[model samples]
Target: MTSTEQAVETFDSLDPTTDEVVGTYPVHGPDAVAAAVGRARGAAEWWASLGFAGRAERLRRWKGVIVRRMAELCDVVSAETGKPKGDAQLEVVLAVEHIEWAARNARKVLGPKRRPSGLLLANQAATVEYQPLGVVGVIGPWNYPVFTPLGSVAYALAAGNAVVFKPSEYTPGVGAWLVRAFEEVVPERPVLQLVTGFGATGAALVRSDVDKIAFTGSAATGKKIMAAAAERLTPVVIEAGGKDPLLVDADADLDAAVDAAVWGAFSNAGQTCVGVERVYVHTAVYDEFVAKLTERARQVRPGEHYGPMTMRSQLDVVRRHIADALARGGRALVGGADAVGERYVRPTVLVDVPEDSAAVREETFGPTITVTRVSDMDEAVEKANDSTYGLGSTVFSRRRGMELARRLRTGMTAINAPLSFAGVAALPFGGVGESGFGRIHGPEGLREFARPKAITRQRYRMPLVMTTFARTPKTDELVRRLVTVLHGRR
Candidate 1:
């Protein structure tokens, strides 16, 4: 084999449940990442030249391929990540919807539009268009591997930039499969390429020549990725860890709130960045709500409703949080420390956990939730806002759903529902504070992978010219008057 081929090492992608190797991928190092990005830089031009209509057609065809093979992809995801088949399919379904939405809406979102010039510059016509930012580097998370990464990948591709994806070390197989599917649609160029390995490989991609990086992972990793990208002054969109909370008002529908809380807290083994980690219920309905929630949570069993924790290392984190909560005088209404098994974490529900307890304050990316009783909606909102992460949140109230949702400090909020914001491709998705910045879905997402280009042309010249050397004191005085007339009283 050539040295070029020998230089790249191989790593095994194991089934988290069985610890059996499901697939093996090359451990692409810094040199390999650089080569992939170099190729993407060239491919980006061809992709951009295709224009919106051409790219849309290609994306539509690719979407068809994904839809047709949805089951196959779901199986691969389940095997690699240890999620249930239905949950895997649900993620793929959402991913396909986003791909379709990005394809159909990119033109409207990123296309050029006329801008009104100020009265002083009325003689000029201004237009601003979003242009492709060449290559995009996407570092994806393992949880919801297909859906989360595609939020960046599909949008970036739709916006006319080529993507070089570095999936999590745990889900390289899924990433490779996605790239291969894209290759079938756009076989002409390296429009989408895959680089799989550990954190070093992701760091390499961050430091490469890609125009921007869209990273979805832990906040600590996001910081490291940001620092690496800073060396090249590259832009980044971070969808980091979130300790999301759910609020239930006194007038909320008890049944609906219970179902939403259980699903949001336990889905994907609670590995979701936006999954509900804390619940604050109005004291009037606190007893009833906790009773209903615990009953529903009891019905959920690991390896059936959900699966094992995908990352073995996370088991310890979950155990620590649960143990800490108990140690701090928190009571377990449903599951306690014993819920965290060797491979799986049973649905754990803790009550009266101290606000400072790790279970309430930290991002316990496991099947765990903490419930607290609040005096009213105000207290609930205040407690919900008391986190460094402001990612996704849920509000359940018949009368004050929207009101409470707006009060909570989060990027996206679901009123009387759970995680519905992610389904609507028109709404931007991301967070504030430690949850990271920039958006990954909707119009904002399309623009995230693009750069704005502003253009102006002199339609006609004014007699009182302010920008030319030919201007006199009279022109300057006239310009001052015009400015005063337009804004002096404002």
Candidate 2:
């Protein structure tokens, strides 16, 4: 059979709200993934040769294209992901900002700079710079597809790496739209490409010869991707799932805290990786907070502040969690077992939930939150910290916001707001433990897709050299004396 005939398999992208066929894309298999990576390898050389300035110009042009056609992109995002157009617009705007920031600041962040040679190597000149990692394979998530993937894509391109993106099956059209816009700005080379399909296709990308992989998805899928990449010893940045928590302090503004909790738990149907899945309130404010939270949560029906669960299978998970919560003596203060619909999940709030319940321990990627009361701030912090996933958290306290935020074991924290850390282009985003590792966004993100290269130049030949065998005895004695003088005292 001809290669074209063999590669004719395709999949339809559907709208979660109506189950309508939004678009279709090829089910690119291993052979296609490999070919894409090979093309990216050659493209990486040409892209890198463009240097920081050339890439930045192209990226800036790409940003202009995105801004000029923002409405069209938001439409695609909204249609494919079932998110509100406003929410989609907000994500795209953040993505444009990230692209601009990466292009504007790549040189300052990754360019070569002189470094002190230290006391031992006073006669040597030293420098360090970050070089591109050739080709990067980005496996994006359906939730916040544009904003989440651009967190890596823009920075990777700005740092001089070619990207082979494999967006989620649910949002391939959005990915195709982004690549189409980027190609208009950079038509010279295949700097950015797309391969669309399901988990097998993503597995193919992970096992391919890409220099690095940036993945954003569930922790189970993240582990599988990491293991697949390990076969080639390829580096990976895994942005996995999170059962994030929010702490309500005794001094927090009750109205503000209630608003944050409602928005944080119900936005995007609570499918956010950094979404508030659990809440720990000080006993002093537990009753008041729960009452207000329940009222606000009831106002948050599906199709208003949030949309349907993009992945249909997620509906079952949501049902299971709520059922488990109710069966285990948990009281549903808002929408409960009946809240989960065929596509949309009504906002549900559970209180007095056991800490070990699936609703609390696992990521309930739905419009639901578990609120547990604690005796004091210490107990609140302890309960919030007792989780395997440490992705993002929130603390609502006028005075102790930062203090409580610091105490939570999370990558990013929003003090008085809901998921505000993601909008800031300068703060790093990632998680620890089960939430995964490697940062995206800010300076750390720009460096994530690049490898540091260090250079040392000897200004002049020195008689007291320790790296060569020309004169070892005197050099060894001098090195020992210097080490003792410098570090021994400390």
Candidate 3:
């Protein structure tokens, strides 16, 4: 059967709040995915052939199209993710800004650069440049559909690679619309394509003959994707989940810290990978801080401030964590077990939770946060750095904010601000340890999708060459003397 006919299976993307069908898409299998990659190979070469200036022009135009139809795209994002219109617009705006930044900075970041030849190799000239790795397979997450995936897609394209994206099954319509937007700007080739389905489809794309793979999801799924890509030894970038923390020192601005924590923990219903899941407050102001936080959280509603949990499976996890914490003697200062409703989860804040409890140790991915009391900023840093996840962190301190932020063992940190690193296009986004390796933003992101090429040219022959078989004993003696003169001083 032809590739088109082989995709007989189909699925519907549903609204999380009402279970309404938003859009239906074909469940593309191995054959369909491979066909898309094969087509992308040629497109990648054609795209690369368009030098830096040419590609940047087209990318800016794509950004224009997205900007012009921002409302329509935001509607699609809101429908699929069940997020508020404002939240959807925020993510889309960030995505477009990244696209524009990547397009404009590619030449300066990836272009050829001169490398100095040492005194010993003065006869040689060296230069370095980054080249694209052709086709890339991007397996995106559903939480921040447009923004997360585009973190890789935009950089990969800027580095001159064609992309074949497999968006999460829950948000296929959003993926389809992104592909459509790209096609409208550059109608000549299939430079960017979409494949939608379940886990099997994602696996098929990973197994396909793609140059590289970029994924954003849980650590378990990232491991599976890594193992599959290992069969081909293909390069991969995995952006796994994070159980990030927010630290509040005794000298912190109590009001500002409370506000940042409320927004960081409850925004997006606490589905963000880098969202503040844990807050370590100094004992001096712990009670007062908790009171302020509780008051702020109570004012935030599910459907009004945020939206329902996009993934239904996360509801049970949130409920279990709350029950476990409560059973373990931790108290709920704001919402409790009943906060987890059928579709929406009210902002839940727990206090006096032990570090060993599941609610504090695991990723709840819901509208719940744990507040722990620390003796000092030192203890706060110690407890915050104890997580296997080192993705992002927030520090709220008037005097020691910058110092504490630098001490946190995370990829990025924000001081006196919430989720500030994520909004900055210049910062590198990724984590060490279990949070996953490889970066996906800033100049590091562009280099992640491309390979560095080092070139060397011989300027002229040396008067006293040591590499030739015809070298005399005098030449060796002179070289030894020069080495002694250059290194003996050290």
Candidate 4:
């Protein structure tokens, strides 16, 4: 059979709300993935040679194209993910900002910088810089398809690497749209390429001859990717699941806290990895907080406010969590066990849930939250930190917001707000523990896809001659004396 005939397998991307096929794409297998990577190798060399200024200029042009065609891309995102145009645009906007940031800041973050040569090597000049890692394989997730994946993709591109992206099968059209837009600005080579398929395609990308891998999904999937990449000794960045929490203190603005909780929990059908999944309110205002949260949650309709669960199978997980919570003596203030529908899940606010319950311990990835009342800020912090996943958290305290936020065992935190850290272009973003490892924003992200290169120059010959065999007994005694003088006191 010809190559086209051999690659005849295809799949349909469906609208989450309607279950209608939005688009059909080929199921790219190992051969296709390897071919894409091989093409990227040449692209990587050419892209890196462009240097920071040349790449930034092209990236800026790409941003303009994205902005000009924002509505069209948003439509595609909405079609596949079933999110409202507004929600889709929000992620797109964040993605554009990230692209801009990565392009503008790559030089400052990865450029060579002079390093201080210690007294022992006073005649030597030293500097360090980060260089591109050739080709990068990005396996994106369906939820927040634009914002989450671009967190790594844009940074990798700015660091002068060619990208072979394998977006989630659920949103292949969105992925294709982004690649096309990039090509319009960068017609010289295939700097960004898209391969659409299921999990097998992603596995192939991981095993291919890529320099590094950046994956965003469940912890189980992240572990599998890590194991596969280990065979090639390829470095990876995993942005896995999160069971984030929000704390409401006695002095916090009740109205603001309620609004944040509602938006964070119900927005995007609560599929956000950093969305507020749990809330801990001080006993002083627990009753009032619950009343307001329930009232606000009731006003959030799935289709109008957010959309249906993008992946149909996610509905089962949401259903199971709510059922287990209810069965374990938990009560739903708004939508209960019946909240989960065929396509959409009604906004559900659960209370009196056991701390060890699945709904609290695991990432629900749905528009549901558990509100637990605590006696004081201490209990609030303790309970909030009682999870294996430590990704993001929010603290709503007028007087001690910063203090509490600092104490939380999370990678990122917001004071008196919700999901604020994600919107900023300068702050580093990632999580520890089960939530995943490595960062994807700020200077750290630019360096994640690049290898650090250190350079040293001999300004003059040192009297001691420490690094050569020409050193004599006098030189050894001098080195020992210098070390003793420099470090012995401490």
For candidate 1, lDDT tens digit of each residue in 1-490?
A: 8766655579999999999999989988899899999999999999999999999999989889989998899989999999999999999989889999999999999999999998888899999999999999999999989999999999999999999999999999899999999999999999999999998899999999999999999899899988988998999999999999999989999999999999999999999999999999999999999999999999999999998999999999999999999999999888897998889889999998999999988999999999999999999999999999999999998888878888889999999988999999889999999999999999999999999999999988788788779889988898889889888995
Q: When superposed on Cα atoms, how far off is each prediction in RMSD?
A: 1.2, 1.7, 1.5, 1.3
Question: Which of the two candidates, 1 or 2, achieves a greater TM-score against the reference?
Answer: 1
Q: Can you tell me which runs of candidate 3 are displaced by over 4 Å?
A: 1-7
Clashing pairs in 1: none
Question: What is the lDDT, from 0 to 100, of the residue 301 in candidate 3?
Answer: 91
lDDT per residue, candidate 2, 160-187, as tens digits?
9999999999999999999999999999
lDDT of 3 by residue, 383-483 (tens): 99998888999999889988999999998899999989998887789998878999998999999999999999998998989889999999999999999
Q: Could you tell me the TM-score of candidate 3? A: 0.98
TM-score of 2: 0.97
Give the C-alpha lDDT of model 4: 0.94
**Where's the lowest-lDDT run of ten residues in candidate 2?**
463-472
Q: What is the lDDT of residue 268 in candidate 2?
A: 91
**Please, what are the lDDT tens digits per residue for candidate 4 over residues 1-490?**
8766643799999988888899999999999999999999989999999999999999999899989999999999999999999999999999899999999999999999999999988898999999999999999999888898889989999999999999999999989998999999899898899999999999999999999999999999999999999999999998899999999999999999999999989999999999999999999999999999988898888889999888888999999999999999999999999999999999999999999999999999999999999999999999999999999999999999889999899999998878989999889999989999989989899999999999999999888887778789998998999899989996
